[model samples]
Structures are given as structure tokens and as C-alpha cells.
Target chain A: MSFVSYLLNGISLGSVYAIIALGYTMVYGIAKMLNFAHGDVIMIGSYVAFVAINSMGLPIPVAILLSVAACTLLGVTIERVAYKPLRHASKLAVLITAIGASYFLQNVALLIFGANTKSFSSVVKMQPIQLAGGQLNITGETIVTVAACIVIMICLMAFMKYSKAGHAMLAVSEDGGAAQLMGINVNGTIALTFAIGSALAAIAGVLLCSAYPSLTPYTGAMPGIKAFVAAVFGGIGSIPGAFIGGILLGVIEILGKAYISSQLADAIVFAVLIIVLVVKPTGLLGKQIQEKV
Target chain B: MKKLSKTTKSSLITYGIVVFAYIFCEIFMRTGHMSSLLKGILVPLCVYVVLAVSLNLTVGILGELSLGHAGFMCVGAFASAVFSKCMMETITVPTLRFALALLVGVVCAGVCGVLIGIPVLRLRGDYLAIVTLAFGEIIKNLVNVIYLGVDSNGFHVSMKDAMSLQMEPDGLVIIKGAQGITGAPTDSNFTIGVVLVLITLVVVTNLVHSRTGRAIMAIRDNRIAAESIGINITKYKILAFSISAALAGAAGVLYAHNLSTLTALPKNFGYNMSIMILVFVVLGGIGSIRGSMIAAVVLTLLPELLRSLNEYRMLIYAVVLIATMIFTWSPSAIGFRERYSPAKLFHKREKGVQ
Candidate 1:
């Protein structure tokens, strides 16, 4: 029964990672750049949601909508101000700029919120579900997080499959020059991708805070890096891959903590990533790109 | 020959800068004009310079982005500290002991670099960067759990705890898990650090201009072309990476010896530290050795110089970082620079005279 409970908890945690990893994969797929600032955007979104719900006394859904809108605008603004001008710059230059933007966001949060950690009140008000005569328990946050992850994943897949904007995104990701030649708005598609990714990040931030019940400026950084690891684990630029990788990574992390020394759990997770990459260089589902002379 | 080659002139200028800085510092200290705070950072400044120059060999010269430089530094620091701690009694001569400790640090880190690079360098671009990041995290995590001790019955190692080590009653714990190693000999000073910096500059700059350096750069420019030309890609990559790792290890030795307690904290030896070093490399202009050295010194001193601003320090740093990146890399900024560059102006004046 305890083992069953641990697995459930792992899946719940994994769902949060999946949500974050989806943002990373989408951005990387279209832009071909690792928006290192994406994690800090999660921090900003959570703070916005925190302010809206606690200070303004708004409804949870309304707070979430406000947070999403703020993050979407921020995402587009960052892309235009910091990233768009560097479209033809070296990859490292773009990466460093993204890092600078991340530092800027974190510093801003520090100044505004101070260095103290906020105790996030759980937005999920429902009671935990007891199964097998209360031997196993699942919290409402867990159920909501997992269900939200699944719905988002499905919606995203359907969007890419059917929507006109989604088709433009697919075309842009496939080949930016060719897509532009075919009358697709390359820059607009990329901006839409960032907007969508940042909006998902806001939701992920809320769910993450509700589950953890703590909010700090640095909260998103470690998880962000782990989600990036998950993104690469499943196969970067692949949507379904991020989901599977996130779940597997989350499960492995929790199980490692339970069965092995908790201190070694992080090492074990990274080691597994290394082994996976060594055996499958491109990743579990990453397409092998051939070099053209 | 009446004139020096371009590379030689540049190398001479780099060496001249370091010598001039050393002489200036010496004069300031002698005249009682140096602050305690500024004096304290002299050794660390050298450490950063060595780290920046070495990482440039990989990221700049070899054109591979490595996020594990700090991991190698952690390995070197811990290895050298442990060596110094165990031999504190037996090695009566501090200089010889410190030299041997430096050797141990360099070897351990270099070996780990080779071991990691063999598997990691096979991947390219983002995959390679992520793998290095993973390896770095693994190193930090593993070091946090390690427990080591020395006693009359030799050394005892355990992952569980001090009790599990099962050392004799008189055993001395050198490494106390997360507490890390303590009481290592403080045998480093500003002079030794500067000397090491000079050595590193010589080795790295010489390597960058050598045949092997050219081969590495060729691989960086075009791997397929280099491979077609019969250059051994794997060998040069590993060689350059390991050498860079070894120099970072040397910096770690200087860093460890200058401090009383050596702990593997994330701020000192984690992803952030690696990125900080990379920032030095990138901001200095990738592949520009002289620029990396100057950038490391200036950036390290910037925060200290801005101590009056306190709260706004990091914010200003972030803004400056973004502004510098834009100035250096943005298309319009580059065009603006070239249009009014000093060299271009000098050439125009010469053309007018002609």
C-alpha cells in the first residue's frame, strides 16, 4: 500500500515536470534556442498568481487567468526586446542573453518580494481521496495536477494537428526559410510559440506551488533545470517525448529517494540521464539529424 | 627580423599586462594604499583568470561548450585538500607538500575529465551541453555524500556516516560529509597565484597557437572537413578538454590552499559557478585569450567596487551583462563599432596621407 502511494505521488510530481518540460520543448522546437529565462518566468507567474489570490482576494480561476495573461505578455516582450535582435547571432550569444534575462527576473523578484519564502496557501480546497479502506491516499492537488497535465497534453496535440496557427508553427519548426517562402509568418509563429509556452508555464507554476506549498524566488530554478533534463531525456523538440521523460524522471527520482539514500537520489537521476544519453545519443525519441556538406 | 609576428605581439601584450598588474599591486601594498578587502581577493582573482583562460580553450578555441568546468574544480579542490590534510604532520616542508598536493589535484581532475569527455564529446550542440551539466550535478551530489577519514589503521571510507567508517579510536575525520574537509594547510598567496596564472597563460596561449591548437580550432570550425583531412577528431577533442580541465584543477589547488575550510557549495562549485566562468569567457569575446583574462579581472572586481550600491549590485550586473551582449553581438552594434573603430580611423588617415 505504501509502495502504491509512493508511485501515485511520483506520477503527480511527474505531471508537474511534464507541464514545465512541454514549455521547454515547444520553445526549443520552433526557435532552436534554449530560453534559459523560461524558468524565471515561472517564478514571476507564481508571484503574480500569489498576489492576485492572496492580496486582491480574487477567485482562483481568475487569478490563474491573470497570471497566464501576464506571463504571455512578458514572454512576447522578452522575445522582442532581448531575443529578436539576436536572431542571427551565435547560439551561445542567445543562450547568454537568455541567462541575463533570467538573472534580471530573479533580481527583480528578490527586490519586490524580498528574500523570504512565502507559505503558499493551497488553492485546491478539496479533501484527499482514501482508497483500499484508507490504506492509500491521494490529495486533491495530485488529482488536479495529473488531470490538468493530461488535458493540456491532449489539447496541445489537437492544436498542432488541426489549428491553422499550429500548422504555421509546425511549418516554421520544420524549416524557417522554407516556411517563410511558403507565406508562413515565421516571426509571428515563433512569438505565438513563446506566448503559448509561457502561458503553460504560468499554470505549471501554480500547480507546482500548490503541491509544494512554498514560494521563493529560486523555487523554479532547480525544477527548471530538471525539466530541461527531462526535455532532453525524452528527446528534445518532441512533445510526447517530454511527457514520457518527465513522468519517468519523476518516478525514478521518488523511487530512488524511497529505496536508496535520499541524498543520492539526485546523483542517481543524473547518472541515469548520462547512461541514457550515452546509449542513445539523440535521446529516446529525438530524430537523428544528418549533417549536410 | 625587424618586426614581431601578430600572434607574438598579442601574446607579449598579454604577458606584459599581467606583469604590469603585479608590479602595480606590489607597489600599492608596499605603500600601504591597498584595502584589506581588495588584498583578500587577489588570489581569487588569479583563480578566476586561470579558469576563464582555460575554459576559453574549450568553448573558444575548441568550440565546445562545457558546463562541467566547476565540477573539475571541485574534484581538484577536494583531492588536494585531502592530500594536504593527511600529510600535514608527515610533510614538514610546506612548499614541497603544497607542490605534491597540486600534482594530486591536477591528476585527479584530468583523469575525471578524460573519463567524462570520452563519452560526452560524442554528442554535439545542446545534447553535449546537457550531458556536461548532468555530469557536473552528479559530481557535486556524490561529493556531498562522501565520508573519508584517516587513522593509525590507514584510511577508512564510507558513504553512510562517520560511525560507519569504523576507524580506530584515534582516527581523524578529514572529510565530514556535507561539512567537508577542514584544517587544510593554507600555503597559497597572491604571488604564487600570479605565478600559476602566468604558467597557465603560457601553456594555454602557446597551445592556442601550436599545431595541436590549430587542429582543435579546425575541428571547431568544421568537424566534417577536419575529419576528411585525416585529423583525429576524438583525440584532439579529448586532448584540449583534458588540458582545460587540468588547468581548472590547478586553479582549484590555489583556491583550496587559500581557504581554511574547503566545502563543495553550489555557489562555489555548481552549475551557477560554471556559468559564471562561462560568462567571463563569453563576455571577454569567445576565442580571445587576452579578452578573457581582462574580463575575468574586471568582472570579479566590479561587484566589490560597487559595494556601496549593495541591493542594486546584482540588478546592475544583470543589466550590464545584457547591454554588453547586445553591444558585442547585435548586428547593428557590430556595424556601428566597425564604422567608427580606431583601427579603421587610423587606416583612413594613412590613406589620406598617401
Candidate 2:
């Protein structure tokens, strides 16, 4: 592939990665917990779509929206079931619970979906959008995924910046105790954060199906890890950074695969992480917060 | 004061019991009546015991929630497998080749352990979890591309090839490939495995009970306080990690030699295996060596005891894990309620270091 085409593939992947990264960053910002199960939540989102499109025979758009809704509810339910009870526990306790939640979700998926891989129909276009003298053949799915992610991110940014509920979320993320004292419903905002993050994850899941039709219980593992790298690269709590990092990481990964050995691509991404730590530990686009003693 | 002395004396005697246990295994393996199949079970139990315990060294005693302990094991497994191959191939003297191969494997895995440790030791929370997860994937992928020295498929020789190289005129040595490293000289019977496990147990027990171990535990409890109190948190983290990695490497060496297989199947050692060993740590209670030991044995044997249960084995394991977490790791484990709320537990410990 030529350089322009390489960059284009990178951006297409980057957009999907950015959407997923937002989920990790937002939950981390609010809960200060890694939500190890978030990757599994993405898994749940994919399966939700599988049931909708494959089993229920719903229209593609309806299936996509239902998957997002189901995941949003599931995300909220996870908080109430797993996290709420551990609100005052040690980091290790909560951490383990998150892992437990992850395993629980995966095992349940296995039981429900079986160990076999689920095939999916394109939520977007199966046809490629040919452009620029056959140099660029963007898939209809890629364009929709990129456009949808950009829109959701913009709306999230606007809500956090301007909307009363969104600002309440900001307060809770900044200082849960203080936010509580100021009469904000900290629990509700936290739930809202999970719900929104899960919905976003659902969108990424749908996009993944459009891109790669085979879905397995373990399918979320790679994408989740990559988006997490994006969240860290951009700065864990910085929304804009998550977007920038996610997309940039996707591009680098693809380009690295094309130009360099695929074996070294992962290494190169992590090498970027190691270098970033030496240069700016808080991440690129992230504000440095002082460690509280 | 009395409790400390008794505990110390009991732990010291635990080593004696471990040595005795190995001797018993030696006798059992040599006895004419015992089946090789039984020896297989006993021997693998020893190696896996070391693996689970060494991993517990990081996940349990050190209190670092690493999700890549198996990656360290892979390093150990591959290093040993590759070494055994080179020695058998390069050296004409069969005995010399065997010894060198095992030696090279252990050392290479030890080095790999240290290399992966540097960037990750200071990381905390789920970043460590995710990074280790990434590290595991990277290792698994790297193994896939190693070309295992050729075969009928091509130039990748596997554990199968290495095993075939080990020969005995008296008909003692045996080897096999993905068929499962069949002829490995069968040197890795129960006694050797048990002896290695004992050595690992001793090293890990000593390390966790040392001052460095205390520092690790302290760091896990309160990072800022431990650092302020002059604990070199990062140093101890790396120290624990490297040592634990070395121990897991040792186990992998024992596993390959005993099984007599040179197969490089990354699929076997995965995130689930890491999680399974971690379940041993948590089910037994983290920060407790005795807990790790007891949990390792039970977790290892539980699947065997459930042979009749078969497919339900994983389901049972999953259920047991979920229940354990709900019972022990959850805030509700202490019976938190809406009337008092979970946050009250914090106020009670507010004067204490977080």
C-alpha cells in the first residue's frame, strides 16, 4: 500500500479505537477504578448485537440501537451489583471484584453464546466506497463508524462542558466527596457515566462486526487492550486525549504492520508507552495531578 | 511473642517435610509396582505446584495484581525448550548436550523475566493488569513466529524434534513432538519435580518472610506511606517480580524436561491460566503464603477430582471464584448495609494511613 492509503486505513481503525478509549477514560475519571471488566462489557455489547441481528432477526439499525440500550442497562446493573457494594473497600478488593466481574461476564457469555464464534451481518455497508482512482476504497462501515464516533465524542464534550447533568458528572469525577457535599447525586452520576461509556462501547462493538464479522467471547481482548493503550497515551482522564491517542495508536499499529514486521508492531506501541513515561508520565494531553499523600 | 516463635519453628519444619515428601516421591517413582502414569501425575503436580506458588509470589505475597504471570512461565518454557534443542543438535556427546540444554533454558528464561520486569514493576492499579495482559499477548505472538527450528511443515523443529534427539543405547531415552515430547529421557519424574518444588518453596518462603518482603507488603497496603517510611518500593517490586519470574521459569524447565516435550504451544499458557492461578491466590487469601500453598494444591487437584463432572469443571471453577469474590473481596463481605453504609468503614480507619 502507498503512504496515503496507509494513513487512510490507520485513521479508519483509529476512529474505532478512539470510541472504545473514551469508555476506559471516562470510567477511570469517575471511579478511580480500572474497571477491568470494561473489556468484558465490550464483549457483552457484541453478543447483544449477535442476539438482536442473528436470533431476533431485527433490522440492522434496530439491532444496533438495541445492543447499545441493552449494554447501557447492563453497565448500570454491573455497577449496582459489583461496584456499589465495594465503594469503601481497598483498591485490591475492588480490583479483584472488577476481575471477578470480567470473568463472570465472560463465563456467562460462554454459557449463553457457547464457545463457538458468532457470525455477524454488517450494521453498515458491506460494499467499499471506491475513491481517488482505486487508491482509496473506504468501506461504508468505516465511514459510518468514524462519523458516529466523532459525533458521540462531540456530544459528550458538549454535555460535560455545558449541560447541567454533564457538569454534575464533571464534579463527581473531580471530587466525589465534595460533589456529594454540594448536593450532587454522586451515585447517579457514576451510574450515568457507566451507562454512557457502555453505550459508546456498544457503538464500537457494532463497528467491529461491520469490520470483522466473526465474534468470539475473547474477541474484545485485543481491541480493549489497544484502546486502553490509547487512553493511557492520551492521558487517562482527558477526554480529548483519549480520542487523539486512540486514533493515533490505530494509525501507528496499521502503518507499523504494513511497513514494519507485525511481530514488532505491538512492541513498538508499548515502546511508545515506555518513552511517554520517561517524557511525560501523566500522558500527552493530560493535566498532571499531584499525588495526594 | 510465643505465636511468632511457634510460627517460625513450624515454617522451618515445613522445609523438612518438603524434603521428606520428595524422597517418598523418589521411592514411588523407582518402585516396580508404580505405573508411569501415576508418576506423570505426581511429577506434573510438583512443577505446577512451583508455578502456582511462584506466581503467588507476585499475585499473593507481593500484592501486585499482575495478569501476565504465565508470560514469565512461557519465557521459562521456551528458553529451556530451545536450549535443550541446541545442545542436543550442536554437541555430539549426548549427556553433555542434555545438561547444557537444561542449563541454557533456565538462564535464558531468568533473563527474560528480568527484561519484562523493568517497565512494569512501578506501575500500579489496572495499568499493571492491562500492561501485563499486553505483555502476555506479545509473548504468545512471538512464540508463534519463532519457526521452532523447522519441521515437515518447514524449518521449525519443536519439542518433538528435541525429544527425538535424546538417545540411549540401552533404550532409556524417548522423545516426541506435538504428539507431546514423548521420549524426554523421562528424567523429569516425581523426585526431580518435587526437589525443584522444594527449592522454590524454600526460596519463596525465605524471600516473603524477609525485610524486603515486609516492604513489599507495606507498599501494597499504602504506597505513599511505604515510600515515605524509606521503603524503596520500586526496587522491591522489581526484586519480587524477577525472583517470581525466575521461580516460574524453573517450573517451566521442570515441566518440559519431565513431560519430555519440546512443543511451543502458546495457546496452552494464556490469560485464563493466569487468572486460574490468581484464583488460587485469592481463594487462599493474598499476602498469606500458607494460603497460597493450600490453595495451589486444592485448585490443582480439584479438576482431577472432578473427572466425572467433566465439562462442568470450568463452570464449577467459575462459580467457586465468583462466590469467593462475593464473600471475601466484596465490601458486603463485612456486612455493609444502607443504615451504616460501606463508607463508615473508612471513617473508622481515617486516623490510620490509607
iRMSD (1 decimal) for each model: 0.8, 3.1
TM-scores of the models, in the order given: 0.98, 0.82
lDDT of 1: 0.92
- lDDT assessment of candidate 2: 0.73
- TM-score of candidate 1 to 2 decimals: 0.98
Model 1, B33-126: lDDT tens per residue?
9999999999999999999999999999999999888999999999999999988999978888888999999999999999999999999989
Cα lDDT tens digits for candidate 2, B183-229? 34334555566667777778888787788888888887888899899
For residues A50-98, could you state the per-residue lDDT of candidate 2 as single tens digits? 8888889988889888989988999999888878877766666666677
lDDT tens readout by residue for model 1, A49-90? 999999999999999999999999999999988988888899
TM-score of chain B taken alone, every candidate: 0.96, 0.74
Candidate number of the best lDDT? 1
List of chain A TM-scores, every candidate: 0.98, 0.96
